[model samples]
Target: MRSLCLLFVTAAALSGCASVRTHQGYLTDPQLVASVQPGVDNRASVERALGRPTFMGQFDNNDWYYVGRELAQVAFGNPKPKEGTMLHVRFDPAGNVATAENLGLTRVVSIHPVGDKTPTLGRNRNFFEDLFGNIGQVGSVGQGGGTADNPTGGSGSN
Candidate 1:
């Protein structure tokens, strides 16, 4: 009975560490993707064959993109991309397919931030400087004959 209980506890603990895979965006079909031919397939036919694109180009409407990614995550960690595919289709002025290209995971980029705070060129300030830095600098009566109302550094007309 103790052995069986131990086995159950071990299984439960191990299950939490198992990796989970998720597929996002377009489901790729190699045969349908290969069938799309430049100069032969137009916008309408491509849409019929592959359905709507994942997204269109931000700058140009003639470019279409079909993106797919598979991410794997273990436990409570962040999901990382395991596989990625991007299909780019460009259209000519006459709406004919100008080019079709497939991009792979080589284009994926992972960035890790250096620290919690972003680096800046200016000098660093402590808690006291940040709290009391602007004490007498603002709204003083006559540091240089300038008040909050008359900030031109000269006498007021009144």
Candidate 2:
């Protein structure tokens, strides 16, 4: 009984270390992808064979993309992509498939945003300044109107 209890605890601990694998975007089929021959298959034919693309080009309608990503997530952690594929299919002016290219995870680049603070012109004010700086500055003129300091109805200065 003692050994069985230890085994149960060990199994439980091991299970915590396991990560969940996930597949996102289009499910790739190698045979079907191979059957899509460039210069022969048009947009309609390709759609019939492989279904609609994951996304179309933003500016140009002739370019199609089929993106796939495999991610792994540990308990209480964010999911991270371990592998990914981007299939770029470009169509010619005649509407037939012109080229098909496969891009791998090696092309992936991650960009982290600077911070929550947005950069703007003028001086940076503190929390107290933001809360109380404009207390006595406002006048009866209202926004875009003139103040007592400047009767010309401008922003008090040139």
Candidate 3:
């Protein structure tokens, strides 16, 4: 009984350390993807074959993208991409397929932010300065000190 209990605990610990695999975005079918031929396949035909694209181009509507990624995560760690596919389909002005390209994980870019606070080119103020910096600087509309409305600091006789 003690050996069986130890085996159960070991199995539980191993299960916690197992990596979880996830599939995100489009599910690619190599045969169907290869069937889409440029110039021969139009927008309607491509949509009929591959359903809908993952997303269209941000700037131009003529570009279509089918993105897929297989990610894996172990324990409490962040998920990392194990495999990725990006299918790009470009259409000409006449709506005919201009180009069809397949991309892989080579284009994936990992970005790390510099820090929590962004640095700016300005005066660095303390906590008190930030709280009371604008004191006695506002409500100068009628102080007669060369305001923006009356640049000459003269009476309103014009």
Candidate 4:
């Protein structure tokens, strides 16, 4: 009997869990924010209007992003958001409504960060210095005969 009680207690404890929370970034309740239009949505005013954003985006200080997510853990936890109709809204440079767009999860593509596209060049290397690395001594580059066997056009040896 004690073992059975303990088993029930253990099961109950195990069942209790912290629900996964997905912050709806950058989004305000649409109806709430929609009612706040056209009166100069400057940073402070907008914040006063929409509270705060979920996260800031890359290469943009003027834009705000709000994200609403579906909770897979529990029913009545969050709206499934109309399948793909997740709400995403963007603010304009002047802090007013730029545009509001809805993205369906079906159309949502995962983004992978590939790091900086520009190959890291020496910061101190001036333009002429960079030219030295790739362009070489004014006219030495590309002068050598082109062939896989003789990439630099030497006598088949270094």
What lDDT would candidate 3 get against the real structure? 0.90
Writing each residue's lDDT as its tens digit, candidate 2 over 1-158 gives: 99999999999998988999999998888888888889889999989988999999999999999999999999879999998988888999899999988888877788878998779987688999779876756764566665445555675555
Instruction: Put down candidate 4 lDDT per residue, 90-141, tens digits, no spaces.
Output: 6676666655455556656766678766577435566776566544344443
TM per model? 0.74, 0.74, 0.74, 0.39
**Regions of candidate 1 where Cα sits further than 4 Å from its true position:** 119-158
Q: Residue 108 lDDT in model 1?
A: 67
| Error in Å for residue 158 of model 4 | 25
How good is model 4 by TM-score? 0.39
Where is the poorest 10-residue window by lDDT in model 2? Answer: 140-149
> Which residue pairs overlap in candidate 4's backbone?
24-67, 25-66, 25-67, 26-54, 26-65, 26-66, 27-66, 84-104, 84-105
RMSD of every prediction: 4.8, 4.3, 5.5, 12.6
Where does candidate 1 clash, by residue pair?
A: none
Better of 2 and 4 by lDDT: 2
lDDT (10s digit) by residue, model 3, range 1-158? 99999999999999999999999999999999999998899999999999899999999999999999999999999999999999999999998899999999988788999899999976788999889876754655457556544566667687
lDDT of 2: 0.86
The lDDT for every candidate, in the order shown, is 0.90, 0.86, 0.90, 0.56
lDDT of 1 by residue, 1-158 (tens): 99999999999999999999999999899999999999899999999999999999999989999999999999999999999999999999899999999998887687889889988876588999879876776746456745444566666565
lDDT of 1: 0.90
lDDT of 2 at 50: 83
Using alpha carbons, what is the TM-score of model 1? 0.74
